[model samples]
Target: MPQLNCIAPKPEHGSTSDPVEGGLSLTKMSSESQNKAVLAFPVQPKPLQLPLYPITLKFEEVVYKVKSEQEGFCCGGTWGTKEKTILNGITGVVCPGELLAMLGPSGSGKTTLLCALGGRLSGKLSGKITYNGQPFSGSVKRRTGFVAQDDILYPHLTVTEALFFTALLRLPNSLSRNEKLQHVEQVITELGLTRCRNSMIGGPLVRGISGGEKKRVSIAQEMLINPCLLLLDEPTSGLDSTTAQRILTTIKRLASGGRTIITTIHQPSSRLYHMFDKVVLLSEGSPIYNGPASTALDYFSSIGFSTSMIVNPADHLLDLANGISPDFKHPTEQSENMELEQKSLRENLKSSYEKNISARLKAELYNSEINNYSHTKDASIRSNRKAEQWCTSWWHQFRVLLQRGLRERRYEAFNKLRIFQVISVAVLGGLLWWHTPTSHIEDRIALLFFFSVFWGFYPLYNAVFTFPQERTMLIKERTSGMYRLSSYFLARTFGDLPLELALPTAFVFIIYWMGGLKADPVTFILSLLIVLYTVLVAQSLGLAIGAILMDIKQATTLASVTTLVFLIAGGYYVQQIPPFIVWLKYLSYSYYCYKLLLGVQYSEDDYYECSKGVLCRVADFPAVKSMGLNHLWIDVCIMALMLVGYRLVAYMALHRVQLR
Candidate 1:
C-alpha cells in the first residue's frame, strides 16, 4: 500500500544575502529515505496538551434507525399532516483524528443527520450511536458542539464580548480568564481571524464587520470547549474561496489533531477534496456513496463512467449517481435506484461505522466502571452533565445576557424628545398648580382629563416604535442562545426601571413641587409611582408589539390606532365605550394606567371646566383615600403581566423569526 504523508519538513533554502530568495533544488533519495518521506493516510497532528495517559475520544456505529416527523405545523388547531419519515435508518460513526464530510445536495437529509446526531431533532429513531461507548441523547450533547449555517451574534456587542461570553458559557470554571483569553487567541490565530476582532456583528446597515470574520467568530465560539465531536452545517457557504479554504484547513487540522469533525459542504475544491479522510454522499434524502474521497473516483469508474474535468464531482454525484440524476427515468414518477442506493448507502454507512470505530471503542461499551445503573444493560447510558443543566439553562444565560444589555445601555440614545416633552408638561402643570387651588368645577374637571389623556402617549410611544429596533438584536441573540428570554425581560424591566422613571417622574416632580397637585408628600410620591406605571405599561406593550408584529411600518400604524382606542375606551377624553366594548378597556394598557394616574393626580372638590361643560369631576378622580378606583393597582398588575407574557412569547418566537 502507498503511504500518504501530510507532514513535511521545512524545505532548505540556499544561503543568499539578497532580499528575494531563489527557488529550491531537489536531490534524489534512496528507498530508505523515500519510506521516511512517505506520509500517513490522514496526517495526525500533535495535541495542544497531551494528558499523562492520553485522554481518548472513542466513536461507534449506529444500527438500524427510523425517525418520523408528524406532518403538521409545529403548533396547531387544525388537522395535522401525515407523519413524514426523515431519517429512515442512518448508521454512521465519526472517530477521532478523522475528517468526515457529509456530502449532499439540497433536501438530501444531510441536516437531519446532524440534528438527529446532535439530539435536537425529536423523533423516534431506531438506531444506536454510542459516544466513547455510551448511547447518544440530550445529555450526550453537552460534551459535543454544533454550529448552524447562520451566524447568531448580537450586533450591539463587540467581537471580544461575544466570543468571551460564549467561552464563559462553554468552558469549565476551572479555566482562568488568562487561559480562556489565550485559548480564544490561539483559535483565532489558527483561523487567521485577528482582523475585525473588536467590531459589532449584524444589522440591516450598521457597518461593523465582514461576513467572513463573523463566521470565524461563530467557529471560534464552538471551539471553546474543544468537544471531541464537532458538527457544522454548510460550513463554506457565504465565504469567498480563500476564506473557505482557510476554514476547511482549520477543520481538517482539528480533525487530524484527534477531534471528530462532521460537517456538510455543498461544493468543495479539489484541494479540500484531498483533505477529507472519508466522505458520505446524499441525494434526495438518501446516501449514495460512503467511503474515501480518493477512492470516490474509482467507485464511479467501476460503474463505467469517469469524472469529467468540467463538472464538479460533488455536483456530478448530486446530479446523477446520488439518484436525483437529471438522466433519471422515473417509473411512473418513482425511482427504483433511489431506494436501492439509499438502502445500499445506509447499510454501507452502518458497516463502515462499525468497521472504523468498533475495535478501539470497546472501552465505551457496557463497562461497569463508568456506567451509572446497577444493571449491566443500562450501563452504557450517561447521566446528563451537571454543567448542561445550567449550560443549557436560560437563567445563567439570562444574567450574562442582562449584563450585556446593561452594557448596551451606552448606546440606547434615550430620546431628547421624551425629556423635553416631560419638562414642558411640568412647567404647564406648575402654572395650573398655582391657579388650581379652590378651582371652579370645570377648571378641576379639565385638569383631571388632561392628566389622563396626556400620559397615554408615553406608554404608546414606548411600546410602539423604539422597541421594534431593539427587538432586531434581541431576536438574533436569542437564536444564538445568548441568554434566556425571561432574564432579558426581567433585566430589561429593572434596567429601564430607573430610566423609565426619568420622564414621568420628572414631569410629576416639577408639577407637584411647583404647581402643587397635592399638599401631602406621600400623595406626591404615589403620583410619581402612577407615572412610572404608565411608562412600564407603555414600554412593555412596545416590546410585545415589536415581537408580535415585525414590520415597523405595520407596528407604527398599529401603535397610532392603539393609542386612540385606549383613550376613548378608558372613558376620559371621549364618551364612555359601548357596554359590549367595555372589555376592550381591559386589554387597553392605557385604561388601567390612566385610572392609576388619575387617582394620584386629583382631589374631588376638584371640578374642572373643559371646552366641554365638565369632565369626570376632579373630586371623582381622587387618590386612594377617596378614589374607590383602586384600578391603579389593577393597571400595575396588568402591566406586569404584559411584561412577562410579551417576553416569554418573544423568547419562543425569536427563534422562529428570521433576522435577515
Candidate 2:
C-alpha cells in the first residue's frame, strides 16, 4: 500500500492565488513547495465573535448500521436478517467561516452523513458529533439550520407570507411581530427574492415561482434565524448551470458572514467546484479523499492518478472516486481483468485515506476536546443562548398558526367546486322531499337519516389528507424546536372548525324550511347544531386515521370502510342487527347523532296519517322505534365524548411521530 502525506499547510505571503470568478474572494495556495501545493486551504479570516455564534462542527469515527432482512433462502436458512452499515468510520472537521462540500455518487451516504452532522439521525448511530466542542443539545438545535433537498413550503402561500409565518413561529418572543416581519423582509432582499415575494409557491400541478427561486426561498427560510451552522443537502440539485452557480454564490456569501456551511453536491462544474473551501469525496460509505477543494487534483496526481485531458476537476475526481482511473488505456489492454482492477483501485484509495488523513483528523478532534471548556466559559456566548424550552408562548403559537392556517386552507375549504357540491346536494334534497304534510311519517324520517349519512363521510374525506400531506413540513418545523406539538394540533383543529361548519350550516338552513320538517326556529337551531357536531366528530376521526397511517391512499381507504360500517349499523338500514355484533352501533358516532337529530324534529304524541285516513304515532315508526329517543341526552353526551376522544387520539398519534 502507498502512503499519502497530504496535509493543508499555512499559507505564505506570496503564493499563486486562484480567485473565483464573479466577485468571490481569492484563494491563496503555496506554489513554491511541492508538498504544500498538494494540500492547501484558502487563508480564511478569523470569524468575528461579537454578535454571531462562531462555532466549529466536528465528527469522529461516526458509524451507522441498520438491519436488512433477507427474503430468499440463504445457506439452508429460510429467512435471515443482517446488520448493514450505512456509514463506516467517517471523520471530518469544519471550522466556522468554511464551506465544506460532500461529493459522492448516489447511495454513497452523502445525505446520511449530512443528516448525522445536523443531529437528525435517530437509531443505531455511534459517533462523536459536537458543536463548539459541546454535545448536541436544544441550544445547538436552535443555532443550527438545515435545508433539505426537497422544498417544503406550503404551495398555497406567497414567498413573503411563507417566511413571515416561519419567523413568527420560530423566532424568539423577544422580537415583536413588526420586528419579525422586518427580519423577513431583510432575508428576502438578501436572497434576491424581492421581485417574486408575492408569488405563490406552486407544486407539480400548479405554476408559481421558478426552480431557482424556489430553491432560494428554501435557503432564505433557514436564513431568517441567522443560524451559526447551516447544513443544506443539495440546494442546487435540480437547477441548470447558471442557476446552480447563483445558488452556490449565495451560499458563498453566507459563509463569508462567518457561518459554517456544508452541502452535498453531485457532478458540479469547474466553476461550481472551486467555490467550496473543502471537499469530502465518498465512495461506498467510506471517504476516499478529504482535503482542500482547490488542491484535490494535485493530491490525486501525486498518487499515480492524473488526468491528461482537459476536464472539470470535479468530474475527474468523481471518476476516481468511482474506482475509474482518469488516464485512459487502450481498449484491448487488460480488458478481461477490468472488474478486478477497479476493485483493487478502490481498496487502495480507501487504505491510503485511512493511513494518511485519518490520523491528522483524530489529532484535531483531540485538540478540540481540550478547548471545549473555554468555549463554555465565554460569558458573551452564554448571554446569547436561549434558556427557555420554546421561543414563544403556547397562546402565541396558536394565534400565529390559526391565522396562517386560515389563510392557507381558505381556498381549499371554500372553493367553487366544494360550494357547488354542497349547494347541489341541498337543492336536490329540498326538491325530493318538498313541503311534505304531517300525514307522511316515513318520508320526513328518511330525510333526517340521509342528512346523517351525507355529512358523515364528507368532512371525513376532506380531513383525512391533513397530516399526510404536511408530514414533511411538520417534521422540518418541529425538529427545529419551533412550537409545542399541542399548540400546532389545537390550532390546526380549531382553525378548521368554522370553515368545516359553514357549508353544513348553509345546507341545513336551505333544506330545513324548504322541506318543512320543523317549522319552529328552536328545532331548526338544534338540528343545525347536531349536524355541525357530527361533522366535527367525523373530521376528528379522519385526522386520527391520517395521523396514525401517514399515507394518503391507505388512510382514505380505511376511512371509507370505517364510515361505511358506521352507516350500515346506524339504525336506519338494519333495524335489528344480530345481537352478537350489535355493539358496533354504539361505536358508530353516526348512530348517536342520527338519534339526536330525530329526537329534535318529532315528539312522542305527534301523530301522522299512515294510510288513507288511518293514523299512527311518530314514535311507533319502525326507524324511530328501533332508535328510540328515550335517552337523547346520552346520545349527545356520547357524541361529545367522541369529538373530544378522537382528537386526543389524533394528537397522541402526531406526538409519537419521530422528527428527523
Candidate 3:
C-alpha cells in the first residue's frame, strides 16, 4: 500500500521563480520515500485551534434507485413510470489527507455519487458508508461540508458581509462575535479572497466579482466551519484553465492540511489532473478504475490501453471508460480483432481493476485502518462534539437572519424602477382625479377604489419575485443546517415590513391630499393605515404564490390572475355580485380596503344631491350597509389574519419543498 504525499515545488538554486508560468515542480519517488515524506510534514495545521480529526470515508456496495415518471402522449400525456438505477453497486474509499477526483462522462453519476456520500440525495439509497468506522449520521453530516456546483449566494451582499452573516448563524452560540469574525477573516485569507472581501457578489444583471472569485467565495463560506470532509461537485466546471488550476491548487493545499477532499471534475487540464492524489473513473455508474492517480496510466497500460506521451493520462483513461476507442488512420493486420478489442475495452478495464493485486491490498489496508480506529475511545468524544448543533440559538438565528434579510431587502426592495413606478402611479392617479368634490360621490368612490387596486397590485407583483430568486439560496443554506425554516421565514416577513410600509405610506400621503377625498384628519389617518395593511396583505399573497410555484413566470401569472379576481370582487366593481359567489368578496383585501374607505368618507350625516330628477338630496346611500361591511375593525382584523395566513402557508410550502 502507498501513502499519499503532498507535492510542492522544490526550489532549484539556478532557476528563477516565475509565479505565473513557472508551475510547481514535482519529483517522482518510491513508496517508501513517499511514506517518509508524509510522516515528515504535519498533515493537519497546528496553528488553527479548531479540531481537524482525520476522516476516512468508505462506501461499500452502494446502490441508488429512483422511480421517475415519463409522460407519454399516447394516453393524453399519461405518465409512464419506471425505476431507474443511478448508482450500481459502487465501492470505494476516500482516505484522510488525500484529494480524490470523481471523473466520468455526462450522466455517469458523478454528482449522484457525491450526493450519496454527503447524504444530499433524496431517493432510495442502499449502502454502508462509514466515517472512521462509524455509520454516517447527522453528526457526520454536520462535520462535512458540501459545495454544490452552482454558487448559491446573495448577490446583494458584499463578500465580507456574506461570510460574516454566515458565521453569525452557523457558528456555535458559545463563540463571541469577535471570535466568529476572526474565523471569517481566517477563511477569507485561506481562500485568497481578501482583495474582493468588500465587493458585492453580483449576478448576471449586476457586475461584481469574477466567476473564479465567486467559486472561491463559495468554498470559503463552507470552510468557515472547518469541516474535516469537504465535497464539491464540478468546482471548476465553468472556469478557465488558469482559474481552475488556481482553485485546484488551493484545494490541494487544504488537503495537505488534513481535510479529506472529494471533488467531481470535468475535462481537467493535465496540470490540474496531476494535483489530485487519487482518481475514481466511473462509466454509467460503474467504477472502471479507483486507485492512485499516478499509477493509473501504468494500470491502463498493463491492461493493453497504452497512451502516447503526447496524450494526457486522465483524458485517455476517460476515453477508454466512455468506450471511445482511439482513431486509427491505418487498418491493423487483423481489423476484426481490433474492433473486438475496442468494444470490450471498458469491461476489460473494470474487470482488470477488480482483480488487481494493488486494489486488493489497498482495500485490506483500509479495512485494517478502520478496524484499528473502530475500538478507540475517541468515538464517544467525537459523538459528544457532534451533538453540538451547528446553528446558534433560535432567537439568535432569527436576529442574524433578520439582519441579513433587512440588508438584502434594503438593497433589493427600493430599486429605482420600483420607486419610479410607485411615484408614476401616484402622480397619474392624482392628475386623473384631481381636486375631487365631495358632492361627486361617484368620482370619490372611483378614486378610493383605484387607490386600493394600485396598492394591492404593486405590492403583490413585486413580492412574487422575492421567494423565487431566494429559493436556491434558501435551500442550500437550510440543507447545510445553518438555520431553520421558521427563523428564515419570520425574519424575511418582518424584515421587509418597514420598507413595505414606507413606500405605501408615502404614496397614500401624496395621493390622498391630491385626490381631495374627505379632508378630515381621522379619515386621512384611517386611509393611510388601511393602505399600509393592504400592501402587507398583497405582499403576503405574493410570497405564498412564489413559494408554492417555485417559478417566476408561474407565480407572476397566478398572482396577476388572483389580483384581477380581487379587483373584480372589490365593492366598486359590480357592487351587486350574485349571492352564490358573493362570499368571494371576503377573500379580497381590495374589497375590505374599499369598504373601509367608503365608510370613512360617506357617513350617515353626509348627503349628496341625486343626479336624477326623480330624487333630490340622497342621504346615507346605504352602500356600506348593502355590502354588509358594518365592522371596520373586523375587516382590518381579517386583512391582518390573511397576511398571517398567507405567510404561514408560504413557510409550510418552503419547509416541505426545500432539500432535506
Tell me how many clashing residue pairs each candidate has: 22, 0, 0
Candidate 2 clashes between residue pairs 3 or more apart in a chain or in different chains: none
* Residues 1-660, model 2: lDDT tens digits: 121122222222233321100101122212332132212222223310113555577888899998998767557644878888999898888877789999988888999999999989988999798776566767667767899999888888899999999989877776656556666766888899989998999888678999999999999988877777899999988899999999999999998777889999988999999899999999889888887898888878877788888999999888877778886453656665886777788889898888877787687667656755453445324433543467789999999998999888867768899999999999989999899777776788888888899898899999999999888988999888888889889889889887799999999989878887879989999999999999999999999999999999999999999999999999899999999999999999888888988999888987888898788888998888899868888888888899899999999999888473
Taking all chains together, the TM-score of candidate 1 against the true structure is: 0.68
Index of the highest-TM-score prediction: 2
Best by lDDT: 2
TM-score, candidate 3, is: 0.87
Error of 3 at 101 (Å): 0.6
Candidate 1: tens digits of C-alpha lDDT, residues 1-660 = 012111211222332211111111122223343343212212213212311100122222322244344444665544533555555444344555677788876766778777666655554555665554445533345446677887766676787777777765554444444444555655666667767766677555556787777777777787765555678888888888888888888888877666667888887877777888877776555455666677866665565345545665666655553443334445675567668864564555435434543332344333422442232123223242322343435555556655766666545536576667778877977786555643453344355555556665665566555446666555444433445556666666667665566666677667666654556878777767666666666666665666677768887777778878877776555445568866887776666655665666554454555335554554453332232454455667777897577656655554445343
Sorting all predicted structures by TM-score, with the top scorer first, yields 2, 3, 1
TM-score of each: 0.68, 0.89, 0.87
Cα lDDT, all candidates: 0.57, 0.81, 0.77
Global lDDT of model 1: 0.57
* Superposed Cα deviation of residue 299, candidate 1 (Å): 0.5
**RMSD value for candidate 3:** 9.5
Error of 3 at 572 (Å): 1.9
Cα lDDT of model 3 by residue, 446-482, tens digit: 8888878988888898889888888888878887888
Score residue 524 of candidate 2 by CA lDDT: 92
